[model samples]
Target: MITHPKPQELTEAVARWIEEIRPSLDPRNAFLARVAANALAAVTRELTMGEQAQAAAVERLEALLGHGGTYAALNWELCEELRAGQMDTATPGLLMALRANVLDQLAIDQPTYRHEAS
Candidate 1:
């Protein structure tokens, strides 16, 4: 009989593996670093924006439809409703926002700002 690792254990192991490899990988693999950075930034943004987006949606609804109006009250669900009711189509804005937010986070986490010599 084979025993599988628990979900938390698996996650922890993966985290450890990443931590061990990230240093060498960062130097040797710019593409990998960029991809990893983007991914990390994206997840961070989504997790961070999830709440802010919900709040912004609710606020917009409240402004237009009275304070009681909300996704639940408007017969819509969370992310989908917000997606349907954003400025412009949500796809472009969302993708752009996600990338921008992630890039910002990447900058914050590992700033690479440089000044050109005059």
Candidate 2:
């Protein structure tokens, strides 16, 4: 049997390579290399954690909306409800669910981000 690197692994490798070469690049190119490495790190985190985060978001949306649907549909419905004044900060789990969803996304997008909640 043959094995291949997973997407997360490939991204990690590339990010590492970028970092190793970054010091040799000119100032502008080095900065760009760092940005590229940071983007790859986000991709790696998404590859590793995106599915679970999405599933959890879906579950939270279903429970909050009192129905089931795809993530995109449920998300859209939630937005409509908010716009229509059907849901608000006082809604039993609205803030908590939204906070959790945002935190999960932040974990994948900017794991170093610090906020009041953090």
Best by TM-score: 2
Q: Largest lDDT belongs to which candidate?
A: 2
Q: How does each model score on TM-score?
A: 0.32, 0.94
Worst 10 residues of 2 by lDDT: 1-10
Residues 72-95, candidate 2: write the lDDT tens digits: 999999999999999899999899
**Model 1 C-alpha lDDT versus the unseen true structure:** 0.51
Q: TM-score of predicted model 2?
A: 0.94
Clashing pairs for predicted structure model 1, backbone only: none
lDDT of 1 at 15: 49
Task: List candidate 2 segments past 4 Å from native.
Answer: 1-3
Q: Report every candidate's CA lDDT.
A: 0.51, 0.95
